[model samples]
Target chain A: MSFSKEITIAKSSVPKVALLVLATIFAFGIFEVGFDQGQLFSIVFGEQAYADLYIHELTHDMRHAAGFPCH
Target chain B: MSLFITIILLSGCSAGVIHGLVNLALVEPYLDKAIGIENQHMFASGEAKDTSQFWAEYYSYRAWQKGGQLLAGAILGTAIGALFGIVFGYAKNILPGNSFAKKALALAAIMWITLYLIPFAKYPANPPTVGDPETILLRQMLYVSFIAISGFGALGFYQVFRRLKSKRFVAVLGYAGFIATVFVVMPQNPDAITAPADLVNGFRAVSLVGVSAFWLSVGLIFGVLWQKLQPDRVKQARFQ
Candidate 1:
């Protein structure tokens, strides 16, 4: 007796998980670099984060260079 | 899928780092010059003293920010690259060109013009002292809104182009007209240009160069990586 088998594989579709992950990254990274304003640090440092502006100062140069509005 | 995401991110990070390095060389001087003007203004206004302590803190913060330029470039590149990857994934078949690299480059150029260049024309980059602290939120909203409008508008028009069998140029004209109207209708930056014209102009020029370099690098790198990896290809074989 003889037996025949067939297989097919497709990877054409972009997985939703990957899209979601990339979207999240895109949003977070853009926010961090372009419009952070100490908001990220404020998550941990409370109100004082507003004063420190650690993320803001760190991204200050690029923020201006990349054309994001900055004070 | 993992490979797909990995290559996309890798290309972005690499391009971003390149962008950072380029900015360090081309853009840093203008930043320094602008900040110098800002320092003088602060001294004159008595907002800050030109003392050793002030200098120390200024240098320290400036150093941190200078370093952050590269880091931020990487982050921004990855972020934008992710968007590029997603778009490329969907549009690769339709994009003009024989190779992935060429197609990616084409897409990059399109994006650079729509997302960055047009918005930039409406709200060009300004140096530190150019913007008012009180109006920061409003300015941010304006910049982001313009960018979103341009980007989404391009996407919507692309759909129109795709559906048309001929005279796709109509969609192109439609987009141009739409954007032109928006350019006229949009509010201005609302901030006064107090900085020296030369300094502000120079800064804007370098800023354009830096961003253009990032887009070019991301496109080329992502294209090459995608071509090499063939992440979307999966082969299965069976014999009897």
Candidate 2:
């Protein structure tokens, strides 16, 4: 297939798109749990202490439950 | 093709379960101690109101927490294994000499070394109570940059080795030199870890052990499964 035709075919493939979406979600989830330190949403909204604390508290139990290295 | 993906996912899930169980049995005690220490510090600093109540709750929810850890491990493992499967599939097409099992094991070892061991040693994970909150972003950036450097550096070394195939000793020396350069040039962590030395060491050791167990299991299970599922492939690999 030509390069453009290949691109078109890939873009039209539902399974490919679904897999891409799933992979993206999985990567984001890993980043949030493993590296974000529970400040992901708050970080996107600028540095808001209350928001960060709120999100952290909300995820605190889950983090600990998952055995993440949270304090 | 789907069968291959299923095998990868199953292998990864098994690895993840092993990882979680290992953590629960061997590493959880040290981790609990570290958490207790952090909470004690928070209480002493007036950041927490009731450490006793917190400990009681923590103990009470032990079973639930263990279950959650296992579930998280399985999910994460499946995702990671799927990615690994895709990469290995592509790589096998390009590089055909080795068996799938050997390739998977090699990739697993390289990943364990570069992605986890080196980067983690440089910027070990700290408890939330350990570092200054303001420096969290900078710390994370530094940590991630180190991971990138380590990963890309390893790949670069492999490329160079492939290019200089005739001089294997020189290639080995070149890779060693590159690693030494990275060790020296990588920026030191600016923020001092505030956790007690013992606690920090204990936590790092436990975490490393858990991760090592996970990767080892992933490598072994995937290798065995791939070999079993494709006996013809194994025969080809032997001839190669």
Indicate the DockQ of the complex predicted as candidate 1.
0.50
Interface Cα root-mean-square deviation for all models: 4.0, 11.7
lDDT of every predicted structure (CA atoms): 0.90, 0.62
Q: Is the docking of candidate 2 incorrect, acceptable, medium or high quality?
A: incorrect
Chain A TM-score of prediction number 2: 0.53
Candidate 1 residues A1-71, lDDT tens each? 44444332223346899999999999999999999877898889989999999888888888998999989
As a whole number from 0 to 100, the lDDT of residue A62 in candidate 2 is 33
Best model per TM-score: 1
TM-score of every candidate? 0.95, 0.72
- For residues B1-240, write the lDDT of model 2, one tens digit per residue: 455656777887888777777767765676566667767777799977775787677666554555556665676666666655544553443333366677678778877887778777667755444666576567667766776787677667666765774875675577567766877787876667776787767766766777788888888888778767742221111221
Which residue pairs come into collision in candidate 1?
none
Model 2: lDDT equals: 0.62
Stretches > 4 Å off in candidate 1: A1-13, B238-240
